[model samples]
Target: MVNVEVIATEELGDRSYLAHDGSVAVAVDPQRDIDRVEALLSALGLTLELVVETHIHNDYVTGGRQLATRTGARYVVNAEDPVAFDRVPVRAGDEIAVGAMTVRVVATPGHTFTHLSYVISDGDPAAAPAVFTGGSLLYGSVGRTDLVDPARTDELTRAQYHSVRHLAESLPGETAVYPTHGFGSFCSAAPTTGGPSGTIADERARNDAVLEPDEDAFVARLVAGLTAYPAYYAHMAPVNLRGPAPVDLSPLPVLDPAELAARIDAGEWVVDLRDRTAYAAQHLTGSVGIGLGPQFATWLGWVIPWDTPLTLIGESAEQVADAQRQLVRIGIDRPRGRATGTIDALADGRPTRSYPTATFDELRTARGEDPVIVDVRRDDEYAVAHIRGALHIPLPELADRLHELPDRRLWVHCQSAYRASIGASLLDRAGFDVVLVADEFPHAQELGLTD
Candidate 1:
């Protein structure tokens, strides 16, 4: 029996797995940095026989080519993918042998036109299979069919329904299900509402895509549930099809306060990777505060233009390097320089700005001032229920919709205070008088602030 270890990318909430038999190992859907995968191989003392990609990923660049080149492992991707790179093309029903284990390719096209899932078996004909569903069937929902094209949404949604059922019927109830996009990834039809990996029995019993009575209802529900994803997603397919350039992780030059100020003045992105609250308290004016958290890279990729140069602003070298690693995973690797502890320098003489963090009750009292309440939550969350007349500008769209915002005090809020602080910081930098409604959104309803 082989053992499976999941390598999770916290920034994107993505999962890549390594499956190893006694002598050989296979890495599935690895992120761009091959160091983690190589470390695993060296630690296990097993030779990497293959590196497989389940699909043309539209979220992060894959490290299959690099891993293969570095480790002399054969690279495998679906034959249908129009990738310009060289690799062994896999088709549905094609099986690759790795020592005592067998990886059977299963074509599951819903997330993208060329998506594939790998079923790993112990080579015993009757042994139950373990499936890597890779955005096909997720924890409770399935992959969003709209990532490719809006016109193909209906067709892809139907295909997703059948593909999910195909896995359920072909695999045994005890078969383990591993998904690459889990833990709040935007690639899913809905956020994965349950724990990481579930068994076939558990999914068949609980997953809405599997349990829905008809495909039409499933498609309608799933399609309607999808909200805006990062705009960087559009570039992912072509980049993956061709190939991503190797990430450069060499130490970036540390910019002095004056040099950093010049970059900020020149309208370059000087991202402040601090906690949201800390950022709200005080930050260098014009620095965009994208807190160094799980979703930092996702939002940064979404808001920052693809070719724009970036300069990171953080408190420590560790924080800046960690941000760099997160940025490279999503292919935003052109950080020109970084500045650390600008806040400490500003504390003595230079100017710094802070925004007021208001609770729900406090917002109610201030409502008479007629602040422009900008709800930076996802559109689906806004539709579910939100404060009446709160302007809906998802965090991803906030950068482009600045002209549409009213010229009054902008009070920003999301489901939680995290996004609100980000929105508030953006608004503040854009010269708007900003106030952050820092309480939970549900607390608004509890306090009679929302309809």
Candidate 2:
């Protein structure tokens, strides 16, 4: 039996895959931090035979080229892609033999012009096959079509409908479906509905592409539902097309408390890599708290000025290192410096900043004061339901549009407080008196706080 292992990057809502027959292996859509894949292969005692990319990813940087270079493996890319680096170009109808298995390349466009999916099978014709659907056929929905270009969105959406249908029709019922995106990634047209693994038969019965006999309706809903993705996405395709350089995971220089404060004073980004709750309690006045987690890089990249010098303030050296790994996936190679230890120690004599944490029930009581209530969730989320008089500022656009918010005590919130914490930090750094709403938005509905 062919063994398949999934490496999930839950922060990015994507997955990289490794499959082997207990001896040799092939990787699909490896992230920029090749160390993880390298470590996995080493532990398994498997020889790296091929590193393949279904398409140029618009989320994290691809490690296929770099991994192949390091492993003496052939890097496989779509034949039609206008990529700069040399590789074994593949096209539809091509099949590659790897030991006792066969990998068939199938053209599955719509996520991008030249996207492909790999169908891997053992020699037995009756055995079920495994297909790696990069961004084409997701678990329940399809990959969002608007990421390429606005003008091509309609064209691509139509192609996506056909591509998904094509896959369902061509593949057998029990073929295991391994998609690279749609776990929670914004690349999905809508939130996907499935656990870790699924099959083609599962999709055929429930997938919108196959269920909706009319293509136009699927395209309409998909186009209308496209929300804002991370700003860093604008840079990913260009960098991937040119072949991204191998990541620099070197440790950053340790900064003294004085230099950490100085960097904040110089208008540089001083980010606190502590948990949102702790950072909100007491943090260095100017440092923005984006808790180190799955969502760290996505929010930091969205709100911060690109290429700005950044200094990290963490509770320990390990927290800074964790942030480093998340940032490099989106191409923020190295931070300018780092400061570790207690927030007070790092602050030294500088005044600290703080904000109150509240729930929807508390917000209702505080509403009598007429404080500005800010909703930082996406537009679709706000459109569906929100506080009656809350100001709408999607988190991604909050940094650029702060002037639009009135100078008042602001109660910031999102679907969950995860984004509210980031919004609260940004508002706090801009010298606004902000309150972090540390409650799930659904509670607002329960409390009749939503419109």
Candidate 3:
């Protein structure tokens, strides 16, 4: 019997699997950090045999090559992929033997041009197989097809439609479906219905991509509904192709007050990782507040230039490291320095700024004769319902469209206080008088703000 241990990267909302049968094991779609995988292998007492990826990932750097080097395992990737590094090129119909398990490579494209799925059986051909559908077939929806090229979205969406059906028809109903994307990944075409995994039979019955009868309708809907991904996404494809360097988790150098000030003055990013409330109370001028949260990396990746030199200001060493780990997942490495205990920076003869964090009731009481209200939620969120005449600009597009916003005091809000806080900081740093609507958005409708 094959025992599968799933390592879910909660922050990224992606899962990596380690499947082993007594003596040998294989890792699928690991993150850039390999220590977790190493610990698993040591505990299980299984010799690593192979490391594999379903496709070239555009979400985060893969640790397959690094793990392979450490364990002396063979690295496998799609034969059709044009990666610069060498790997054991695999295609459909190729089977790899690992102790009591047999891994059958099955082509399942549409998430990317050269994606593959692995069907594993416990030696016996008739046993219910376990399928690893990387970015192809997810929990309730398929992966988005627009990530590769906008021009080929329709073509890829059509391919995705066929691919989901193929998995249902090809595998038995009892086959366990283990996918790499879903949970909270933006790569998903829609929000996943249940857990990280389910059976093929369950997916066939419930997944929209599988249940949709008309292929053209599915393609049209999928294409039209794709949301904005991170700006760092474009950089991942090339880095994965060229092979990402092994992750370094050593402590970063602390920046002196003078150097930090110079970098901030030179227009380099110095992100403060404390919560919005703390940042709002006191923070060095010119530093953007992207508090350490689930969407922290997403907004930072969205707003900052890819090549900008980044420095971090955190309340503690742990906070700085946590922020760095999240940033590295999206390929933002080599941050110049980390400034811990940044409260001291306020006394360095440099400017410090603060903004008001207000509730919806407060905004309601003072709405008519005040600063402009800007909603930084996504386009769909705004479309569903929003404050009637609030200016709409998704957080990802905020930096680009700053000039379009009025040069006046601005009240910024998102679905909740988290993103609104980030938006408020960005506006404040940009020299606009800003107020953060730090209350829950649903309350706005209940309070009649949306009306």
Candidate 4:
């Protein structure tokens, strides 16, 4: 088999692959940032001969078109995709020859109407091939069916069941399976088993799609398990289809304290990009603290109104630039302004606020005080396990439903404290007494906080 390198964008829970034969390479499902890919190609002394898109992705902007243009490689996409760009379109039963690799296309239309899987081998028919199953057959699960068209969820789920069975039966059991989603992406249907890498045999043994004999049952189970996804997902496909411009990661215009305060007063978003602990100690009164981390872009894009004039506050320009890269992946193309300095400097002696952060044990201590408990996890997470008396307002919905909260002090939490920290900030900004439960969920059970 040709040598394959997996490049993971852990923050987005997606992986892009580069396969080569010591001379030429093929890139699959690349993210918007092309520098990473170019760096890999230069390091390996391999020329990128082909860049492929498994489908018009609905999770993040694709860099295939731009990468192809810059490298002068042939950009290949499904012939059936209605993207607004020129490409070398191929269909099922077509095969392409690279240096020592042969790429065979297979139709796997469950993830989207035109999704394709690429099986690659190094000319030896006996050698097990590697299949790049973009969003079709994941580790032990499949790609979610609702993103393309929610109304067609049930129909697409049925298609997903059959497509998975087809792949398992057609390919060798030892064939290596590389999926692009399911690490933590909402685009992936949570499978029964997951690993860093898997094979067809492993999936055949444990995958729900292959194990479930009845198609209708598989469809129903898959559909029933679906949950809410990020609001930014709705824009990824359109941006991909319209053709994304080359990404720009340059520093943004600096905003002084006076301008930052003016933006907040004008009802614009001025988000703090510091860590949660530092934010809890001290933060600008009106700025919402969604700390800079893996989930920062996900929560920030979800809670803020789309296209709002946004300003970011960080302790350094590097922090703000990192946030900008994550934002561009989800189609939050630009930040209106930015500030990089200490909270004290950004505050410029203006009003500042701080809140208390506690664990489940501390929460129990404050129970007699009767503080409102709010669970900000998604419906699926809360449904599986949660404290009995806690209010269930998901983080995505919390900003919109603030008026529904009681005027009492509220304690906010999630599966982990990442989301809870963000929820606490929003509540604090709205003039509520907020205590962030900055710990894991298992502690709640240990402390007898769960029902």
Whose lDDT is higher: candidate 1's or candidate 2's? 2
Question: Candidate 3 — worst ten consecutive residues by lDDT sum?
Answer: 341-350
Error of 3 at 59 (Å): 0.9
Candidate 2 accuracy as lDDT? 0.90
Report the C-alpha lDDT of model 1 over 27-94, residue by residue, as the tens digit: 99999888888898888898998889988888887887888888888999998778898999989999
Cα lDDT of all candidates, in order? Answer: 0.85, 0.90, 0.87, 0.90
lDDT, candidate 4, residue 296? 84
Model 4 misplaced stretches (Cα beyond 4 Å)? 191-194
Predict model 3's lDDT versus the native.
0.87
Summarize candidate 3's per-residue lDDT along 1-451 as a digit string, tens digits: 5678899888878999998887899899988888889999999898999898998998998889989999999999999999999899999989998778889999888999888999888876666889999999998899989889989888888888898899988899989999999978888888888665699999999888889999988988888889878778899989999998888877789888898889989999889998989988888888899889888887788788888999988878898888878877788876889888656653387678898888888888877776589999988889889997899988877877899899887889998888888888888888889889888999899998894
- 1 or 2: which has the higher TM-score? 2
Total clashing pairs in model 2? 0
RMSD per candidate (Å) reads 1.8, 1.3, 1.4, 1.4
Each model's total of backbone clashes: 0, 0, 0, 0
Better of 2 and 3 by lDDT: 2
Quote the lDDT for 227 in model 2: 87
In candidate 3, stretches whose alpha carbon ends up further than 4 angstroms from where it belongs are 345-347
lDDT of 4 at 144: 94
